[model samples]
Structure formats: structure tokens, C-alpha cells
Target: MASMLEFRTPGWNPYAVKYSPYYDSRIAVATAANYGIVGNGRVFCLGLGPQGIQVEKTFDTNDAQYDLAWSEINENQLLVACGDGSIKLYDMNVNDFPIMNFHEHKREAFSVAWSPVTKDTFASSSWDGTVKIWSPARKDSIQTLPVGNCTYSTAYCPSNPSLISAVSTDSHLRLFDLRTPASAQYHLTAKIPVHVPSPAPLPQGPSPPAVPGEILTHDWNKYNHTVIATGGVDRVIRTFDIRNPSGGPASVMMGHEYAVRRLAWSPHASDILVSASYDMTVRLWTDGSTMPAQQASPVKAGIQLGIMNRHTEFATGVDWCLFGVGGWVATVGWDERVLLWDANAMLRGQA
Candidate 1:
């Protein structure tokens, strides 16, 4: 209750929010006007104060911003994934213009993530069906991996800078290891489908037709390096282990009434994650893995800890504060509001 804070973003609908790794109270948001279909966008830097959330800086862009990532090596810099198929690097200390820009994708850049282990590098996924790796010092993308489908989210392993993961419109999760040679198709090491393959001995009833949907979001477990959670149009959250794909989802949780748009695993707990959905609610969950593939029906047993439904429009983004006791989270929605609340309090019915 008391731990919650809210700020209204004027004339913009936020698509993503990220807490600064260097400062617990400093946050950045990527937002678009007219709900991203058209019109310009903006990036906002904010600070949490005793009175409320205060605007620290703002940068306006010619196109909508779909996502953003903070630089791990520089406190003043961040990268924006843009609707114009470009990535713009901005320095908070500089003027409104971006200090660096990389353009190659043929369509909108949907996601951008800073490498956790390698501070100098970052990756961006796009509607152009490709993922490109870049460094702040370089003018062009250092590497490119084609997915052949619109990629919605991308992440770097917290423990291994060489390992990367992406989820796309094909509903498949792909892992690429940069350590391997580019000749090896950019080290596309693993691929896992989002749906669960039917168990041995099909049920007695008639088999149902398959439903195709897009995977809109995914995140790597910060503590458990091999664990990956994915969500999408199916409205199911499934966890997978990169070591095994034939075994199917290690766990599955179903509660969202609409597509999940974005998600983040808690920095404090590997099994805990928070999801924002088009259904206008943000829900917390325990990934419910009973020691990997050893458990039977792990997903059926996964628990939904709590749900936050204060937003009046689609909830599009969520992030956890990495510096504190770790329950602190920030969520942004189409209602043009950013919410800061304690996840633990939501679980206790206090927020």
C-alpha cells in the first residue's frame, strides 16, 4: 500500500520501463503516442523522490520507441529500439539528439538488451526478422543473426555474455552462442517451441487442432542461467531449460485473459517473475519448477502469487529493482501511467 508510487506520462503510451542498475531510484521509460501505430515517441528519465516521481530528462523522437535498454558500462547512456528500424543511443547528459545511431533492419526494431556479462556490447531484435549485435564504439552492427520471423524480445544470459536468447512471432525460443564461429549460422545452438507436445499415448478423445500464436515476450532467469520463461498470444507462461527441448515446458501457468506483452524475472529469486498483459493487469508468479524435468505436471502446479489491476488500459511493461530488498517493481501501461509497487505486498494483499 504505502510502498506504491505512480506517475502519469503526458501525451505518451509507455511500452517499456527499466530500472537503473547503477541507481535504485533512477528509471527510464520508452513511450509512443497514438499507441505506436503512428506519430512520434519519447524517452523519459525519472527519479523517485519523497514527494513523488520527478521527471529528470526527456528526449523526443521522430518515430515510436518500442523498447530500450540501459548501458551497463556507462551511467549516462541508454539504447532505444525504434519504429523506424534504427537503434539510437542517447546520453542523459547530452542534448536531445542521440549521440550514436545504427540503422540496418528493414522494419521496426522491437527489442534491445544490454549484455549483462559483457558491458560494452548490446543486441537488438526487429520486425525485419533479424537480430544484430553492436558495441557503443562501432558505427555498424558487429554481427547479424536472421530469425526469419518478427522477433519480439531478446536477452543476454546474466552469467554468460556469449549466450543469447530470443522469442519471435513463430512461437519458438532460439538460443545463439556467440562463442561459435559465424559459419555455424551465428551459433544458433537451440530452438524450442512454446507449446507442449502431447505426452505418449494420446488421450482417448479426438485430438484438437493446433492453434498458432506469436510469442510476444520472454526473459532469462537471472540466478538460474539455464532457465527461460516465455509468454504470448496463447496466454500461457511456460518455462524451459536450454539443455532439453524434447521434454517440453518445465512448467506452465495460465491466468491471463489476454496476451502477455512483457515480463521480467525477479533479480532476488530465480523462480519468481512478473508479467504485464493486454488484459490490463500485472500478475506475479512462481515458475514452479520442481527441480527441472523431474516433476510431473509442473506447470499445472505453478502458482500465481497475486495480480495488480489498477491500470485502466493494457499493461505493456514491467521491471524489478535490482539494488534493494528486491520486491520493488515498476510497471507502465497504455493508460499513460507508470506504477511503482512492492511485489511482496501484492502477494500479501496489501497493495
Candidate 2:
């Protein structure tokens, strides 16, 4: 809501944007041509400056990239997920070409996430219905967890190196434990159906059967590790506690007119989060629940803090600045624009 600093990715539609953990001013964007339906793609490394945002470096790829992850161990390195079923590791300090490449997924690699806890490993999810774990030093995937459906997002738990979470086209959120046996399907510890209907009978006219749709994105709460937020084609954002999967969503936030495409929890607040949607708007919300570890019941129907309507196309990616005063956020969309704004001012009507 603050006066936004905007930059456009010429001829490309951005898919994912991530702020570097080691550098608060640096951000990376994964993008594709023609909204990734066909054609090539690029990854842009950008920097925030007094003049606005500027491109620091750019890399071109034969296939569109759907997602990217900054290296947890090396500030100069990052990984990109490609439509060609490959993951490429690039070092910003070196030449433009990737220094390492891994091709194991049989379909487009949709998401990539570096381990926040281990700092040496990363994971990727693919349309091939598999999530693979990797280390940059290794030439092959260390492990693969089959989810039996197209997986759109995968990430390592920030608090536990041995744990990972993923959302798939199966409309389920799954948890895997690396400590378990590595077999045909890795250790799937939990699976929560995202669109299950209420157990209580409906009160009025014919109740529409529950509609199950693909979960496009999800993120773990940085302050409360047990809490996970998921959004999808249903246009509903729901938070769940992994420790009590049977209890359904702890909180549900609704307002998006179209499918929710991306979400990120505020690094500074346990209850604050932001979402981007195909409706062409970015929204901020409070999950309306105290940390389950700290309280017994969660407040339902979270509050919408504000909405930013600057994007003209589907908003695909969103990330929070880890070092800011806690209101700054970066969002990229199919409109080919990346906009940085301060959510604190947006919520207070001061921007």
C-alpha cells in the first residue's frame, strides 16, 4: 500500500519470486513466455535500490521455469525448476550458464525449495507426481517421495531438517518424514484432504456435494511450525494443524474471486499472511488463530487486512522480506510486473 516500486520482465510472465535469505535487498524471479503454455523462459536476479528495483543478472532457458529457490548454504547460488523436467543450479558470481543440472522428473518440475534447517539440501515437486530431495554437490536425487498426483509445491520444514510438506492436484496436503524407510514411496506420514465437507448435516436447501480441486500452493507458518496454510482452485484459504489433522482447518479466510495461486506467511508475525490469486489482486489476512501450541481453540473466519489491485493478470508469486520492519513484500504476476509495497501502511490506510 505504500508507494510501490514496480519493474517489468519484458516478454515474460513471472511465476515465482523469492527474496534471498542472506540478502534482504536481493530477490530472484522465475518466469516463462506466453504464461508458460509454450515457449522459453528466464530467471531474473534483481536488487532493491533507492531508484527502485533493477536487474542484477538474467539467465535464459529453453523451457519455462515454474519456480526457484535461493541456496541456503551459498548466497551466490540458487536453483530453478524447469518445464523440461530438470533442475539447474546457478551461481550468480560465475558465467550465465548453470554450473550443475539434475534431470530425474519425467514432467515439468513445478516447485523447488532449499532446506531452511539443513542448509545443504533442497527438494523439488513435479507434474510427474513425485517430490525429490537433492544436495547441490550430488549429481542425482537422494530420495523421491511419490504423491500419486501432480504435485505443484514442495518445501522443507523450516524447523525440522528431516521433515517436508507438499500440495498436489489430488487436493491433499501431505507430510513426509525423511527419517522413515526409503522405499517405492517415501515415508508419507500424513495426508489431509483440503476440501472435505463438514460432518454436520446441512440446514437448508440441497447441499452441494463437496467439490475437490487441485491445491495450487501452501506454506508453513514460520512462527508456528505445526500450522500450515493451503489454497487452491476452491478460492478458499484454510489453515490446519498437523498435530490434529482430524479437526479440519483451524481457520478459513475467504474473499478471493478466483483460484488462489500463491501464499506466504509473514516472517515477523505468527498470524499474519498474504495471498495472490487469479482474480488479479493481492490480499493480506490474519489467520485468526493463536498458535495451537499456545491455545486450545482457534478463531474461525480470519480477517482480511487489505487488498492491492495493481496487478492486471493472475498473481502467481509472493514473498516477504525477512529483514524489513515487517511490512515489505514482493509480488510477481502474469502481468509481467513485480511490485514491492508495504503492507503495514496498506492495512492502516496510510499508503
Candidate 3:
């Protein structure tokens, strides 16, 4: 097989791309016209073939689409977050229109994540300073958690169905344990300041003081339930231990010349992750917790393993191919291009 493949969306700029949990040959992209400023949005269902990536279906909407998630419960269904504060559920078997529309958010819906454990519920973060939990079978949200700022990203803990987490413009990472009583603060568990200064100073000198900045993207480590990675306008990615929020970042990964747009931890490797950025590049990194050098160092810092710079605009989204040997990756950007490549091949070339 070829190491790389490309597909163009023409007028639509993609914000997120997700590979199907059910099919290795299928993927979905959430896209917006005019760079999501003042035009319509679209969700494209793409199929991978011997020839290349092909569009199998498309659903259009009046608002700009920002993010999307494949339905864990149904192979034929998916959800899209939109600029007009709405979430639309689309069925590939159905034609044209969405099967259901959820419109409770008062601002742009920035991100959506389906619960990997529960499979029946999903969560959405919005610019309206809230994260709402929803079930596809209902019109209204089951519960709404107050973020108190523009919440950009939210996800259900892959290992625990009752645990939820979100990052926001306030530079804070908030965790919600649904198992907790609502009267005990809406199930809110912990709030960690993502940009705090490291407790252990560098060997060369004292560490610099931390500066709070807007956090745009984050993802939980699939293998380590307590570790979560976050990146944002600060152009640095930091991982935190939910069990010890006050201890500071478990490890810091720094390299992006521009703000990090999105990041995903590899399903196959506990230490491996890939991030897309405004710098028009996708980078692979290892949190270095498992590395011999990092284990001996006073401060743990992640190392950049490799980089992919084919995108001509902001690289907004990326995902790993779960069904394969675990190095094939799919990335989408504002350049209207989707690039699928063998990340293992890139690492081999670097080696």
C-alpha cells in the first residue's frame, strides 16, 4: 500500500476527522464553508478504497460545523456540533436531512465526544460556557455541567462511564464524576489549572512562572485513565494526572510554533500521541514517562518523535487508524485537504 493518500473537500474546510470504530475503510469529517466564519456547514462520510479517499455521503446544515463523533451504539449514525449552538444526528442510511436536531446551547458547539463505555450517551462543550450530556433518544440534555467559561473540548473517560472531563478558555481542566450526588456541586469532581509552574525545578535553573492561557483541545490517554493531555493558545501541550491535580503536569510537550488545534493519544501505545496545530503541521510525541532519560531527569518532558507538514493551512484534526498495525493516521485541515499516511513509515524514515 502507498504510504500516503490525499483528498480535497473543495470549498469546505474541515475542522475534525474521525475514523469509524466499526469499519477501517470508513471515516467522517466535519467541515465549514468560508473557514467557519459566515457560511454553511457539512458532514462528509468518506470511504477509503484502492483508488483513494471517496465521499460516500454528505449532510448539509445552515450553521458551521466544528466537530463530530461517530455513534458508538450504531454503525450507521453520527453526531455533529455546529456554530448555531446545535447538535445534529445524521444517519448514513437516511437521505439528505438529519434524523434529529439538538439545539439547547446558546453559542457555537465546539466539540462532541461519545461515551466509549456507555455507548448510548455523548457529551458536548460549547462557547456558551457549559458542557451538556445527551442521549440520542431524547430531545433535551440529560444534564448540563457549568464550565463557567467557553468550554472548547469535553470527553467521557474511556474506562469509566460515570466520569467526564472538559477544558476551557479559563485555562482549567474540570472533571465531573456523574456518580456523585448533584447537590454536591453538579457532580463536579476536580478543577486543575493546566498552566501552573512545575513543582520540580529544571536541573539548569529554576522553572519559569506559569501564565494562564486559553485551552483549546485535550484528550485522555486511552491506556492511562489518570493521565490527560491538553494544548491551546499557549502553543504548549501538557499532560496532567487527575489523581494529583496539584502536583502539576505529569509531563510537558512543547514544539508547535502556533497554537495546538487538536490532539489524540494513540490507541496502541500508552506513551504515544499526535497533535495538529495552527502551524500547518501534525507532530508525533512520546510523553517520555517510559523513556530511560526522562525517568532519570528531575523534570519530565515529552520528546518529539516526528512531524508531518504537508497541510498548507491550519491542521485542525487527526485520528489514528484503530484496526491496523496502529500507525496509519488521518488528518484534516483548513486547506480543504485530508491526508492519510503511514506514521510508522515516517518514523522509520526518521530513524
User: Best-fitting candidate, measured by TM-score?
Assistant: 3
- Name the lDDT value of residue 272 in candidate 2: 95
| Model 2 worst lDDT window (10 residues) | 200-209
List TM-score per model, in order. 0.94, 0.94, 0.96
Separate clash counts for every candidate: 1, 0, 0
Model 1 global lDDT (CA atoms, 0 to 1): 0.87
Write down the lDDT of every candidate, Cα atoms only.
0.87, 0.89, 0.92
- Give stretches of model 1 more than 4 Å off: 198-210, 290-300
lDDT tens per residue, model 3, 1-351: 247888899999999999999999999999999999999999999999987888899999998999999999999999999999999999999999989899999999999999999798999999999999999999999999998899999998889999999999999999999988997588888999988988775433335349998999999999999999999998888999898978888888888899999999999899999999999999999998787764344467787889999999999999998988889899999999999998887777641
Model 1: weakest 10-residue lDDT segment is 200-209
Model 2 C-alpha lDDT per residue in residues 1-351, reported as the tens digit of each score: 547889999899999999999988999999999999999989999998887888899988999999999998899888999999999999998777999999999999999999998788899999999999998998799988999899999988879998899999988999999898876556988899888764443232222235889899999999999999999998888888999877777777888999999999999999999999999999999987663332333326677889998999999999999996988899999999999889998889855
Ranking by lDDT: 3, 2, 1
RMSD of 3: 1.8
Error of 1 at 215 (Å): 0.4
Give the better candidate number (1 or 3) by TM-score: 3
